[model samples]
Target: MASYRGAPYIAEQLQSILKELGANDEVVIVDDASPDNTIEVIRSITDPRIRLIESPQNRGYVRSFEAAVAASRGEYIFLSDQDDVWIPGRVAAMVVALESARVVASNFEMLGGGPRPWIPRLLPAWDRKPIANLLGVMIGYRAYYGCGMAFRRDMVPVFTPIPSYVHESHDLWLAICGNLSRSITHLEKSTLLRRLHDSNETPAGFRSLGRIIAARVMLARLILEARRRLKR
Candidate 1:
């Protein structure tokens, strides 16, 4: 997990994590040197399974995640967001999926103070039925949400030192790398309650014509770069 200025909810998130994790499970939290009290809050949690790594300085999400995964000892690593809530049974389900697939991702529901946001509400309706096929469609588009996915430790080397300039989305990069070695699977069940807050890297919105075009352009650039690297 990569954390920056998420002190307000880090404690709650950790509590939820501790509750869900089994005695054998291990968690590694990487603090990206938040200017806030995130580090202090994490230190207060006294669990042997939870190990905290404090970066000497601030690193962006991409680099921080790379560092965290590199330092992790778990055979299967689940990416986590500092603010989201993981529903019970998430780890068990993910473990089953990873046993046969290179990557596994689950569906998520967005929740907040009021009626569901327009984007979240429209997702299930706008997309086709039986979301299983959504995985194939994601190859040409970005589909994997970081917090909803997990992968085997053996695949870590493929993603480390993330190429400095892939205009493509982060999760897209993970899916692409996983595809090089094995197939990515999408679990039918919702494993997490993904919270939508102002601090999200990308805004939540339904797909519009402009947004579709932009996504295509970004995916194209990413594909070209991948091809170029393979050719070399």
Candidate 2:
């Protein structure tokens, strides 16, 4: 999990996740030097499974999640946002899916009737089409949110060093690696309650044509990079 100024809601989110985790399961969180009491709230949780890493400086969530992934010791890695609540079966569902696939992406619903998503929810049939999945990601259709995704530990090298130019959409970069390798699985159920608000890093609104084109170019470059890494 990547945490910023999440003091207002992180405690509730952590409570939701902690219940689902076992004694051996772990939650790795990297706090990006939040100015708020985010760090304090995390420490108050008192769970041995919760591992919090404090960043010396604010490096944005991309690098924070990267650092958290690096420090994680689990064979299965789950990405999470600090303020969202995980559903009861999320860990079990995604872990079961990951047994056969390198990566798994799931659907999500709005929390407390938060703003509705602009794109359509993901369907189970979509998992079978790798080409379509790649194109969906390229055009910004597939909802490959980090909060709803999980991957195997072996994919760490493939997903990280997250393309120097990618300041955002690290989850999309992971989706690209999964799809490029044709090893992604789509879960039909909503795994978590996504809490979308103004502070959310992912833009909920549409992008300008220029920004859209730039994102496409970035996705293309990510595909090439992922292909090269997989070849090695």
Candidate 3:
């Protein structure tokens, strides 16, 4: 998990994580030079399994997540947002989901917010649904949210050095890479409560023409990579 000024919900998020994690599993938190008490709240947690990595400068969310995953030693990594709350049995369910595929994206509900955004409606059926066209799914309802997803450690290296052209979302890039190279499955169950408030650091919403063109180019490359992976 990567945090910046997440003092308000980081404690609650960490507590839920600690409750769900197994004895050997650990939670790694990356602080991107937050101006608030996010780091202090992380330190207050007395769990040996919780590891905190502090960034000297604000490296943004993508870099922070890549760094955190790189520092982790788990075979499978479950990404989480600092403000979300994981439901009971989330870890176990994702672990089981990871047994068949490298990446697993699931459904989630928003709380204390107006409406849930990016709720997948027109996508493939969600019964461990294997998304063959990663970019195509993204065009409609791109519900590849990190809070409701878990991926294999191998996926880290596949998309780690994220290109600036498609750097808008690490989760999107990772989902595309996983679907193209390995395997990606979507579950129907909601695993977490996504807390949306005025202070959230959501990326810019309006899509410009340049972004559309860039995405088209990126999709072509992903298609080529998918074909190459299929032969190998």
Candidate 4:
């Protein structure tokens, strides 16, 4: 988990993750210099499976994720935000789904103690697509949230240390890899209760048309780079 100033909900998130962890499983929380009590709350949880690492400087969400996942020793890695509530069976369900695939994504509900409806206006994404089609789907619309994503360590070569200029974070890279493997699976059950609030890094919807277009262009560049890396 990569966190920044998540004091209010970090404790709850930690508790939920800890409950689902198995005897051999471990939870690693990497703090990106939150400038808040998020670290304190994480330390308060006295679980041997839970390990906390503090970065010397704040590197934003993308770098934080890279750092956390790189340090983890798990064969499979689950990424979560600092402020969401995950339901039970998340780890087990994903593990089962991943048995025959390289990666798996679960459904999640948007929340913040109320209902808010708004999606990106520029491009509509497919619920499911072939690995070849996933690049376009991701460029046009959002599919996986960081919290709802999990991948095997074998994917580290492609997903990690995400290119510096990509428009988004590692989530997109992971999605691209999932599609490339032609084994992406989506669980219909909602295991994540995603809380939306003022502090969210991403807004509920597109903020401007120019921003959207710029994002698409950046994503196009990312796809080009990915092809070169994948030798496609």
Candidate 5:
């Protein structure tokens, strides 16, 4: 989990996630030099399975997530957000899907019963359609939230050292890696309850035409980079 000024709701989110984990399971949280008492709230949890890595400076959530994935010792790694609630059976379901695919992406519902986002939910039928999925990702049609995604340990090399130009949408980059490698699974059921608030990192509003065009260019470059890394 990557945290930044998430003190208000992280404790509840942590409780939701920790309950689903087994004795040997671990939760690695990389706080991106949060200004709030997020660290203190996490420390109050007092769980041996929880491992917190504090960043000396604010490096952004992308780097924080990269550090968390690198520090994780598990065979299967699941990405998480600091302020979301993990649904029951999320781990088992995603892990089961990951048994056959190198990466798995799942659906999510609104936490407080707000209206759903403009992006549609992912369907099981679209699981292995790499070309179509890549197109969906490029055009902002796919719902590939990092909090609802997981990948195998072997994908670290392919997904890491995230392109220096990628300042946002790190989750989409991971989805690109999975698709380019033709090793991604799309789960049908929702995995977590996403909390949408003003402080959320995800862009809730529309972008200008210039920003949209730039994002498309970035996605194109990301696709090429993924293919280069996986030699696809």
Candidate 6:
């Protein structure tokens, strides 16, 4: 989990995570030099499985994720947003999907109210099969919402060398890298209540057109790089 100035909802998010996860499960929370009392909120949790790492300085989302993954002990690592609430059975469903695949992505519902008109405008309905269809599906949107993704720890080495330029969308880079050897499983169940507040890092609605195009272009570049590495 990566957090910055998320004190308002961080405690609730941590509690929900603890409730859903088993004792054996480990939750690593990384504070990206948040100016708020996010650290104090996390300290009150009182769970041994919950580990807090304070960054000496602020690192952006990409580097924060890198730091978290480096410190985690689980064979499977689940990426979480500091404000979202993971519904019951979310982790179990993800575990099932990851059984045969390296990357498993679950769906999430937009909370803080019902859907907005721009929601559909931004995310159109499309078929999920043939996998190749994802190339285009991935163009204008995030294929695996970062908050809902799960991956094997073994795959981290392959994902680490990814350039920081693509750090903002590291989940997309992971999906593209594992696309060939491991099928990207999309779980139909809504595992998380994704909060869309003013501080969200992801672009929403028609305002994200530029980011969409840039992400697609980056995806193409990563695909080519993957191919080259395979040839070697």
Model 1 ranges with Cα > 4 A deviation: 112-142, 166-168, 180-182, 203-218, 224-232
Query: What would the per-residue lDDT of candidate 4 be over residues 130-193, giving only the tens digit for each residue?
Result: 5435655555544566788888887777776688875355676777667666667767767778
Which run of 10 residues does model 2 get worst, by summed lDDT?
113-122
Which of 3 and 5 is the better model by TM-score?
5
What's the lDDT for all of these models? Answer: 0.70, 0.90, 0.76, 0.75, 0.92, 0.75
- lDDT tens digits by residue: candidate 2, 121-225: 777787789889888898777768888999998898899878789889999999999988888889988999988778987766767999889989999999999
lDDT of 1 at 23: 89
Q: By the lDDT metric, which is better: model 4 or model 5? A: 5
- State residue 30's C-alpha deviation in candidate 6, in Å: 1.4
Highest TM-score scorer: 5
Clashes of each: 0, 0, 0, 1, 0, 0
User: What is the alpha-carbon lDDT of model 1 when measured against the actual structure?
Assistant: 0.70
- What lDDT does candidate 1 reach at residue 221? 62
After TM-score superposition, the amount by which residue 202's alpha carbon in candidate 4 deviates from its true location, in angstroms, is 2.5
Candidate 6 structure lDDT: 0.75
- My TM-score estimates for the predictions, one after another, are 0.78, 0.96, 0.86, 0.88, 0.98, 0.86
TM value for model 6: 0.86
Candidate 5's error at 63, in angstroms? 0.7
TM-score of model 2 relative to the true fold? 0.96
Runs off by more than 4 Å, candidate 4: 111-128, 131-139
Tens-place lDDT digits, model 5, residues 70-159:
899999999999889999999999999999999999999899887778788888888758999999998888869999999999999999
Clashing pairs in 4: 131-179
Model 6, range 1-232, lDDT digits (tens) per residue? 9888989998888888898888798999889999889899889889999989999899787788888988999998999999999898888888887887777767787777687323221121222342553464365434557788888876777666666567677777776656644456767778888888888876554657686688677777877765665445
Q: State residue 155's C-alpha deviation in candidate 5, in Å.
A: 0.8
Model 5 earns a TM-score of: 0.98
Among all candidates shown, the one with the greatest lDDT: 5
TM-score of 1: 0.78
Mark the regions of model 2 whose C-alpha exceeds 4 Å error after superposition: none
